[model samples]
Target: MSNPHKKEQHTGKDLPRWGMVIDLDRCVGCHTCEIACKMENDVPLGIWRSWVKEIEKGKYPNVVRSFRPTLCNHCENPACVKVCPVGAAWQREDGIVMVDPHLCVGCRYCMSACPYEVRYVHPQKGMIDKCDFCHTRVDAGLKPSCVEACPASARIFGNLNDPKSDVSKLVSTKSVTTLKPEMGTDPRVYYIGLDMATMEIKREAKLVWEK
Candidate 1:
């Protein structure tokens, strides 16, 4: 199969169920993806639509470092979508969870409901803001900003339903995991080279803002 991970001419019909694969082995904790996402989305300094989480393991003598690029998981059963009192949070057919800024009343319910803690209330706009997988760019035949900017090529985005797509192949053929499976969100974002430590949900730090 062709390396569908790269931006190229796609020959097949556009598939449904957009998703992502992040290879932890390829990630270097550079935060380039974070900067790219912020620039592309115009996310303010105090908040992040996407962030790179640094995880360190082992004692000082055997120290190991890893990076996890986190965003809205865009779950198959989105908690945010269900909890939005005004229906501001909703999931598209393709699996992106979107917040309608105009309809949002800054209630922060969706923020609380999200297990990934990717959602944040925009202090200036009084609305919720989070990753939508750069849907506008994806619609324009482009990858998400973070995926495009990762120098290590650790991020892969494509339609999960297409068996021929790189993302689908990776998930099928490799060891993969989703964050907080116990939450039963069935998140579309899959991770390669992640350990149980990385998947452990930290409830004390609730929101991205708290981090």
Candidate 2:
């Protein structure tokens, strides 16, 4: 008997341009995505290319909880791109941020320039490292490890430019937000369930620590 629910293989132009939508409402702060990302990318200990940042607000009894999974913003106007002296980092035509590992001189300029603090200097690779948006699996027509491993289905990946795409539809229907909007990075990643209170907590923390 033929299976009616078999996963279809992507081919040619049917392959979607990549984007990620994180539903904060569904996220349990489990850190599964973080572990999945590290394992799939072989990211070493003490140097995470992706991570989860948790925010707790209010006085002890009235506290509210929020979890923000942070990764390279893959900004439309990536500061890392302009700061790289060796031109190792660049934004792709489809809006993905990437680095030429061979071209990187480990100067750490990109690390300093990124407002999101997602870039890291790899000790063994001897190069600047950050999320490549799971380009390997993406190119092979598979979802990113984090997206696949998410137990809550809190993450969605697709093309922002495609009107019919799930990400585009969700953004249109939901109140989505990005981190560090003041930096004018125009981050491609979007988050749902983020509120003013959550934003305020993050803002205050950054101002205190970044100083």
Candidate 3:
């Protein structure tokens, strides 16, 4: 078998529109995907490009545990791309938002522009970094590290434009949701069985950058 991590060259033609569907029902909040993403991307200890949000619902006797796994939404109209003074942040034709480290001046403008608050400035590298849906792996015809590492198989990744794809089918049939839709970012990431907590932003919630 070929090495899946090795980069595969592609001609600039009709490329697939990449997207992800996360089944909140299947997510067990194990944090396995978090570790895999960190390892694959060499993320720092204090911050994370991807993380799980735990929501406790109902009273003790009838309580329920729900988890929301979050990362960059790779929006269709990314605020980060517009707010970047140096044009460091950009979106690809396939709808993946990427930050060019070479162009980045560590301005943190994108961090503020993102409503989801997923983007963060790397303390060590002095550059903006966030999940790009593991573009390197996707370009290599492999699933993202997080998706591959998911023990419960909660995450499904594929072309949303292809009707035959699992992601497309699920979106068409299931009542999925995107975060902060009012922001008009048109985020590509979708969720099934999303809880109320994940939809509401809490100012008291600890930030990833907060020490």
Candidate 4:
């Protein structure tokens, strides 16, 4: 039932490159995003799809806590995809990194390869799972649950390929940084006003491989 008059659809480079931005200035370390993600994704009780990591600095009276929200970076050059022997770890044309549960054998090879240590084994499903930026909702013309649930509107999600997109504008204009940029993954997730102390504290023991 081919429609001879059907219009051509955009593909490859023309499609939207999904990305996210976390504005630390607006974030309150509330863990609301994590709870929203867990509820929306049906994640196992012992694990989380995302979380807000808090780190304290300075003396008691002058102490300050910084927050780093963690999730799948969905990199342009993903280490997981490279190390997945079965090709279970794959990326969309729009740059969303996803694991095909049907193809994944729970080998945990991708887990060892991921520098960010975001992927986790589903306790019941025995498959590696991580955030997919809520692609289903994106295709339905909606935002990711975590983004929509941010009480302070700290998270911004949009097509990075579009110059007019919020993510694109912010990344281009702000002093943003990504985790482990030196690793060459070229992560799409960006953070403004990120505290290196928090990043260091969070990655202290989770990294499986030496830099």
Candidate 5:
């Protein structure tokens, strides 16, 4: 009998889940990742699908700077999905949140519901737009454009369910925090090396705008 075991061999599934861990310390406040995401996604001008948010903290004499790259949190309990009058905005079982432009009525409800302000109504298309976490690229076994383009390797992507995965490992070893823990959205994106003062400023800004 020729190699029966070889013929019966099974191929394990490719990683299905996606999560990102951003190292705030390694980020140089360079907007390279943001630009890369825009270019890759072909997002329109005056409407960024991803962006870098800067926070300056301290008194007049001494100040500290911090940078945060913000995008759709892809929350486990996404408020956008709940508020959509139509079934346009939905989160996939694999954790990617997306919007169906064809079905969207452009009511902007989803935009208002997103606390992170990542969602925007497309100027021309009139449909709400936000980061899809590069679902197309993820399906192809490639990293998201931002993750691939980061020179500092500050953004790490992997399956959170897998304990051996890089994302899981980083979360285990580092001090990680999410954007709005109070909201209880259960955001999957984790940030490391974040300054508490900088986070407070961001929270204050979000509260004022209600975005």
Candidate 6:
């Protein structure tokens, strides 16, 4: 594994704006992605870098289970980056939001400002942490663990700036929507076939952080 702290080289050509698109229609609610993320990032037991939110709909006899995968949105106008007083939270040239654990003072300012509630204080290090799309692996030219481990192939990761990328094509051609578009964050994560009722739901797992 490459050292995650090393600064990656950047050339002046068109930088890829990395993003994701989840095809809810293809998701199986298997939680494979949830497990894969934890294994890859070594996320703490109580905290999650990513998780699947499941909800049952319809009457007893006729019911359906819907899943919403929760992770850092990596927003274009990230509130975490804007609110970080120490500049610990920053966005990469490719739109991935990252945190500098060394610079973080455990102020929790970013945690409060973030709408996604994905950020958490590392139990041991006392630094803020969250999903960075597995930057080290991505920098190594590998797909995110969740993307590769998804059995249904529901999670699509790619360069949104490139029209040829799958994520870009789906986002432009499919009926996709992002979480909290009204917040004006311009979240890079988009979802297809996301239930309208669950659009505003913050999910029970996300609330555990406050306790």
Per-candidate TM-score against the hidden true structure: 0.87, 0.84, 0.89, 0.89, 0.85, 0.89
**What RMSD value applies to candidate 5?**
8.6
Ranking by lDDT: 4, 6, 3, 1, 5, 2
| Residue 194 alpha-carbon offset, candidate 3, angstroms | 0.1
Candidate 1 accuracy as TM-score: 0.87
Give the whole-model CA lDDT for all candidates, comma-separated: 0.85, 0.81, 0.87, 0.89, 0.82, 0.88
Model 4 worst lDDT window (10 residues): 1-10
Output the number of the lDDT-best candidate: 4
Clashing pairs in 1: none
Q: After superposition, how far is residue 7 of candidate 5 from its true place, in Å?
A: 36
Model 2 misplaced stretches (Cα beyond 4 Å): 1-17, 195-211
Q: Which tens-of-lDDT digit does each residue in 1-211 have in candidate 3?
A: 4322223333344678899999998999999999999999999987898999987888979998889999998887789888888777877777778888878899888898899899887989999999999999999999999999999999999988788999999999999999889999998899999996756677797866747
Whole-structure CA lDDT of model 2: 0.81
lDDT of 4 by residue, 1-211 (tens): 4322222333666789899999999999999999999988999897887888888899979989999999999998899988887777888777888888878889998889899999999989899999999889988999999999999999999998899999999999999999999999999999999988886644366665734
lDDT of 5 by residue, 66-118 (tens): 88888788887788887888778877767778898767889998888888888
Residue ranges of candidate 6 with Cα displaced over 4 Å: 1-13, 200-211
Query: Where does candidate 6 have its weakest 10-residue lDDT segment?
Result: 3-12
Q: Which stretches of candidate 5 lie over 4 Å from their true place?
A: 1-15, 59-61, 200-211
Superposition error at 4 for model 5 (Å): 43
Q: Which 10-residue span in candidate 5 carries the lowest summed lDDT?
A: 2-11
